[model samples]
Target: MRPFLLLLSLAFSGLLAAAEVTLTNGEWPPYLGQQLPHYGVASRIVAEAFALEGVEVHWEFYPWARALQMAERGQRVGTAVWTHSPEREQRFFISEPVVESAYHFFHRKDRAFDWQRLDDLRGLRICGTLGYNYGEPFQQAERDKRLQVRRLPSDELCFRQLLAGRIDVFPMDKVVGFAMLHEHFSAADRAQLSVHPRALRSDPLHLLLSREVPGNAELMVRFNHGLAQLRDSGKVAQYLLDAQQPLSLAP
Candidate 1:
């Protein structure tokens, strides 16, 4: 009887001491969030991949900027669906890209305008979520004062602002915009919005580790191995295909 109790105590202690990965997940639908369960393909894929290596993940959801801040502050270990920009590259270690995201402009169809280049955006109000970088063109426009940009707290807010005609254009990742529009927008709202034929930029999405996280190299290595296993097993492609189904983010 005493032996049985001692063994149980040891097991519980081990459980309590397990190496846990605390992750910061934001409410980016079809990528990471509670609003759409299976839609978090990247998050779920990473979680599943890491589990194969005996690593456990615990997630806390926050606004996108806050999630990035938590990870940077070491209050959280990592973030997903992150763009690997040079500025951010210096701030964090990045995993190999898990997916690619293209940037597109969402605008009201009846109010069409020829947005040929960054210079063409002069005097237009553009909407974007805080902490998101949609490549160089828009950034350049921002620097030149050619474009008026509003930083929303989330994608849902951007959609709402766009629907209300408060902003001239909403610049978002093609996949993310599509997912959000399908998940949140009403049929009427959908009718008003359309994607620009011209792409602003296309870049790969990476899993980012905060500078404060310990064992960065080892964590990245392990994740690479796990991701390789998933790719070899045909799981990654399947996840991407599965998450392609449309959802709305209309406010």
Candidate 2:
């Protein structure tokens, strides 16, 4: 009787655990909005999609690095808008990509930068987000003194500084650049800045779940399933299409 009772208690506990999951998010605009009513684009999408599956999500908005660490430590159940790489793949289970983005350079329209290659950025001050990864070439350039990368706390700060001539160029995802331009910059500022024709890389964005969440690997599967349904039903693409304005895709 004692063993039977213990098994019953464990079953109930597992049920309770499966019913609750907290999602952590960083301040990536249009994807995750820190100051908005709802977390933002990705958060809203994931929330509504998971609701269809009866999975409840608690959204916790935090800085990018903190959110990443929380997801890694299992304190936070999940993170959205994460790029897939070998290192990250080992640490967490990744949901199917809900969005795609291009990393590009934003320069003053009046200035002609000889940015033929990553090495061409030498001696020119380039602004970038602290936690953003711009692929191998730029990272190597930073190491070899071929680029001077200044770390800013956020995209808004980076672009504002760039406009003031405090930084020569700012690197950011083009979607983010368009959002920030509309949110923080005046019409005049928008006219002054232009995204470079060259793209650093195209990345598929995913929801990252820490290994600590109970059955997290399974949860990733569920998330991806919902994402697929949303895409098939035309919800996901419509969200992105709505956000894509004045932000043209690369030909």
Best by lDDT: 2
* Candidate 1 minimal-lDDT segment of 10 residues: 242-251
| Cα lDDT of model 1 by residue, 1-251, tens digit | 99999999999977754466988887766777866665388888878767766678777878777888888887778888687778887778888878877788888877876778787887888898887777766777676777788888888898898888999898787777887677667778888888887888888788887888777667877787888898899989988887874443333
Off by over 4 Å in 2: 1-18, 114-116, 120-123, 246-251
**After superposing candidate 1, which stretches have Cα over 4 Å from the reference?**
1-19, 86-91, 123-125, 148-154, 164-166, 247-251
Pairing residues by index, what is the TM-score of model 2?
Answer: 0.82
Q: How close to the true structure is residue 120 of candidate 2, measured as C-alpha lDDT?
A: 76
Q: What TM-score would you give candidate 1 relative to the actual structure?
A: 0.78
Clashing pairs in 2: none
- In angstroms, how far off is 180's CA in candidate 2? 1.6
lDDT at position 125, candidate 1: 80
